[model samples]
Target: MGFLQRLGSAFSAIIAFLVGVITLVSLLLGGNPGLFGDLPQAADLAALLALPAAVLLRLVALVIALGVLIGIANLLLTHAQRLMRGRALSAALLGSFALTLFWYVARAGDTSLLEAVQLPIESSLAALLCLTLVGGAARVIAKRADIWSLLFVLSLLIVLLASLPWAELEPLRAWRDWLLRVPVSAGTRALLLGIALATVVAGVRIALGQDRAYRG
Candidate 1:
């Protein structure tokens, strides 16, 4: 946790430094887009500066890199608090962290993680299927009527149906896609509004120091 916190802070610093440099260059050369600076007329200024369109694309990459750095900061804050509170490590948390970190290191045509680790798309689906089977079987063997196990069984049923190449599921898949494309898009568009409302309520509650998710 200490290592992760430091790593996150260091990454944030690097991103900030790069952003500052690019912004300075963009303002200075006013067009070259040096390293990560965005200079639209860079080509027009190419003869004056002698660069290419490919160099301009670095600005977009820098923007994306900054976003990733911020995401790591968020994760560091969340996990550091969890660690300080002595929270037990859960399978979901560990698995998600591992997968995210692995994928982050496996991008840009570097599929080494996919080849050497469990980051492949096919592997993920297979793992999900195995988990569903194991969960259902364990519940049945234990003679327990767990809601979680039941939900897994129900989802597996749907997956099994979907996995089959049947005409019935064709329309179902189309409808599912449409549902996600419509309501999901609307929800995403309005997500900040919902977050603002929730933040206000939570802020009032925490004004009295009633929130302890970050408390050590």
Candidate 2:
């Protein structure tokens, strides 16, 4: 676990450094493209900056996808430890089939294969999630029957109302939009600002030689 933590921290630092360098270069190019005659035009500089940005974004996405897959595999292995051999095999086969179906749909791109599998997979997942949520709500209501359960029911009702036909649910739609655009947006901005501030603080500490965890 310590090794994994160190590895994750190192990987995060590398990603941060790359992003910082790319952002600095993009700013320099955008601000003064003539400095690099190879990309003198605004469009050329933009394109040059965009290429690395896109590549970095894709790299991050690939890393996240791989991490999720690894986590799921680990979870399955852990659960398989206690299951009967036949049940374990069935679980593994079902998991692999679902993952393969998702992968194929993702890459199918305008093919009939996507059309054939996408809807069923989506519907099944949605149904499963709904059932899980309903069961959880029932348990919570039975166990506590308090404000939290009331809040959950209210939130679910709001979501259902928001999903109705726009003409019939204009008020609920407006309320949802307001909730998202105002409170949610404000909270998101605050969280991002906090992250930026923390990053700056960490950078300052490292540069001042105050952070020694990275040394050993």
Candidate 3:
């Protein structure tokens, strides 16, 4: 049994690696007949190469849709059981979900219900978040009276003040725009690049059968 398991794992890893390589190549090189220069069958070759990637993408989308449906069914089932056990919160959640779903279907997919409820809740959460940030900045300055903390608080205040719709705060708005356009943009790009690199590394590890999860 142990030997068979290892063999199966090896087989699975090989298949995964092959599929990953094929998909990557198809996505990168497919549907670009110009890349082949003046080859006689360039268009035909490109189309052939693109076919696998197209099919794979559709399969992925279908799987995601199915997964979402399964998740919703599981959520309802769990909440229904909880409701039966007199869990008020679960009952309320189930009732709300049912009402929202029915409302959506009855209105032929009109999103007025969502706009009425979700928009207000999101706005309230954003207000709370701003308050929380201000409080956290104050605590940080109190705990550590350093230059970095002062700069952080100053930037936070400037941003908050700039958000107000007053003509007098034009200078702060200019500063905010510069901060967002320069430092914030650079930092965001750096973070995204780092994430992309990490993802690539992890993907390579998996494709090479070096990932522990795939070893099982």
Candidate 4:
């Protein structure tokens, strides 16, 4: 056999062995043993080891959580660096001022000052993001001219119609409700079911030594 094939078989075997060991350990530690309950006094052994096991597990979990948070912060910093570019000092100063304002508003409970300072800033940022998204979507639609682009246009129309005076546009409101309750609801359910089935398949493959995703 080729080296790669031999290596894969060896890896699969090792994974299978680990799966078997984990299954055995889980069964021992009060998992549904059912009719095989009389096999061993393993639960007592698990109870004896539980204190140290819990401490070790908590430490590992804490480290993993901290690592994830640090990774996310690093990613945000990278994006902020790209956005700020040559205005890093100005951006930092502005961010600090905004944070200070937020803290002062929180502690002072003064709505007027916050309303004067925050509303325009928030509105401008929201408008910028919305315009950026719309521009990107428009570009994609212009290039593709597909059914998705048509649907996007239709959705925007529906949103515009829905936002009109509700008393005068009652029919449009009903149309919006029907669109949300029927197609959107069905699509959401289908997506959820697909996710659940995929999760089950992945778990089964991992348990049966057919998946090597964790090896990465």
Q: Residue 46 of model 4: what lDDT?
A: 58
Best model per TM-score: 3
Per-residue lDDT of model 1, residues 1-216, tens digit only: 699987876666565455445544444454443543475765566344433323655766898999999998788678767866887564456566667677777775565655665557677898899889777677664785688667655544554556678887986667556655786578776997899999877754443334423333
Q: Runs in model 1 with CA error above 4 Å?
A: 1-57, 90-116, 120-122, 126-216
Q: How far out, in Å, is residue 215 in model 3? A: 7.1
**How many clashes (backbone atoms < 3 Å, residues ≥3 apart in a chain or on different chains) does model 2 have?**
0
User: Which stretches in model 4 have alpha-carbon errors above 4 Å?
Assistant: 1-60, 69-127
lDDT of 1 at 132: 97
Candidate 2's C-alpha runs over 4 A off are: 1-119, 137-153, 166-173, 191-216
Reference-based TM-score, model 1: 0.26
Write one digit per residue (lDDT tens) for candidate 2, span 1-216: 699998987776775566666755564454444565674476676667667657766897999999999988887666666455555565765566567667767877445654576678898999899889879878877898889788777666776789888797888988878777886689889999999999988865553445644544
Candidate 4, residues 192-212, lDDT tens digits: the string is 999999987877677666775
How far out, in Å, is residue 119 in model 1?
3.4
Question: For residue 126, what is the lDDT in candidate 4?
Answer: 90
Which candidate leads the pack in lDDT?
Answer: 3
Candidate 4 global lDDT: 0.71
Q: Assess each prediction's global lDDT (C-alpha) against the native.
A: 0.62, 0.71, 0.88, 0.71
**TM, every model:** 0.26, 0.38, 0.81, 0.51
- In terms of TM-score, which candidate is stronger, 1 or 2? 2
Each prediction's total of clashing residue pairs, residues at least 3 apart in sequence or on different chains, is 1, 0, 0, 0
